[model samples]
Target chain A: MVEPLRHVTPFWPAFWRGFRALMPLWLGIIPFAVAYAVTARAAGLGVGETQLMSLTVFAGASQFAAAGLFAGGASAWGIVATTFLLNARHVLYGLSLARQVPLTRPERVLAAQFLTDEAYGVTVVHGAREPGGLSFGFLLGAELSLYAVWNAATFAGALAGAVLPDPAALGVGVVFPLAFLGLLVPLLVDRKAVIVALASGLGAWGLSRVLPGGLVVLLAGVGGALLGAVLVTRRGEA
Target chain B: MSVPLVTLLMWLVTYPARLLGLSLGRLKLPPFWLAFLRFVPVSVFAALIVPDVLGSPEWPRRLVGCAVGVGLMWRTRNLALGILGGFGAYWLARLAGL
Candidate 1:
């Protein structure tokens, strides 16, 4: 009995570490948040509405894609579908993570609401280190900090959007893609990973124009994974 | 769309998606898929960031920012530094009218 309580005591500290670890990451998010505002505003979302979207949706990539689609004259359903497809990866995250932390039906429902990239990263890293050792406080702390930083940057971005000149004209649009590329470049640590990343990026780039919907993104992801499997199997045989 | 309404809709929709992820399903996610899931953050971040960085007019300015970001990440291996450095450099370059 006492052992269980003792095991839980370090959870708050773990959460704090996770939160502190996240602060620097938020800096990169500022531009993305600002871009979201520019697009959201162009999409006919009011300043307040844009803020709400950031606060609520909280998935930066999905929001940007959705806003871009909206600005491009996509209907509400189309925007929603785009959001779902862009975010289908989250489903994969939840599925992989479910085995580690077996949440009750209600807790699973609640936890789903806050499953951002930051949360997923923290959960996986920490969960791996101390499997079954993460306390609710730890998860909450990491997630809440991410929530605050994300929403705050978004609010700032929307405010900037209401007054600033077109971000596209000023070349702020380039910042978004560069930031993403910088991230992707680091993760290609192996031949297989590199192949997957390149294939996916290139496939998506080419297919985005011709493929209806985000079939390109889907294809890239699937293609990369299949390529990885084949590579690993060949290596195993050797 | 109203802000609160968007928030409400998110709460309504995202929860179910999360729930669906957890419920035992027929989806036979393989080991490779599981490994791929680990990289989703990197993929998602790249997918989101690449278009804007390469899409802008002042490529030089954004390139400097990218250089700074890479340097920061190499030095510290801290994701936060990389992201922050990149954003800061870009903002500073823009403010300088570069």
Candidate 2:
């Protein structure tokens, strides 16, 4: 069955609004791509393999996990398994977005390729303010802008990684954590958020040593959320 | 199997996850579940960043980068400035032969 557009907004306004909405995200996105490509390169992936992964794979956490696991001498099957498990959340994201966005089949197929945590967040928030729940043009703009920046940044990093005598000598590796930190810092607004962040950060730091790469993320995310819940209920809201 | 096929395999693993979810008829998640998910991004980012910044063998350099990044982010609330400062600080530290 074909779904109709939810609202009557003009295409250009919605599209440009979607494009403009993600401008703040480019900071995290750019450094993120650079960090991943350089990491993949330092892990001994060929420039072609590194660029291809960003072009096709496009999931940050999985790409990072694969690079780290590859560096640790993981088998190909193991890496692919990790990729699937890490990406399982995208399933939830799509379900949520589809109900909100009203995408037709072809659009859903195209949209699925660019779906990620940031894309989902921006679109949902932007959609909420629209007269209807969502707009196709807005989503198109957001997804395409993000897709363009992410790939361009990734390819630049790959080329830079290939040419740099030592990516380490230039501190390329620091971009990963710092880039992530840049995104996370603004969100630490309350005790609950702070607790969740600390708990997850410490949990990840500890769990990473014992568990496989993907498991650390899952367990830490749950642990942090659970801790935040407990803290929220234990005390009155500020 | 050829090794360069790994990225293709990664695509195979990921694409269907989203496609399948989108195919599901309009579904409404429970309220509590939605509330809980509000914390996912912060937790996930922290979880991902901590191990990378602190657990890596290159912690000292990453720590410097993060310190600068956080300091600038705190002062400016500007994502671009904070990230660029972090990169510059890291580069300077490395250039100084740290």
How large is the C-alpha RMSD of every model relative to the true structure?
5.0, 4.3
Model 2 agreement with the true structure over A1-238: per-residue lDDT tens digits: 4554345768788888888877767866876787788888888888788888888888988998899888888899989999998887676567656766766789788888888767766776567577655777788788777888988988898889766455455555676676667667877888779889998999999999998656787788767866765666555431
In model 2, state the lDDT of residue A171: 58
Scored by lDDT, the top model is: 2
| Model 2 spans with C-alpha error above 4 angstroms | A1-9, A20-51, A64-74, A92-106, A117-139, A153-162, A229-238, B3-5, B20-26, B92-98
**What digit string (tens of lDDT, one per residue) describes model 1 on residues B28-58?**
5666555555555444444444333444366
Query: How many residue pairs clash in each candidate at the backbone level?
Result: 12, 0
Residue-by-residue lDDT tens digits, candidate 1, A1-238? 1212234335567668667754554555666678787788777878888877776777777788777776787656666666666556666557656754545566566667777666665565556455346555555666777778778877777777767766566554544454444445556676767666666665555565566434444456556555656666556621
lDDT of each: 0.62, 0.77
Q: How large is the interface RMSD of each prediction? A: 4.1, 3.3
**How does each model score on TM-score?**
0.73, 0.77
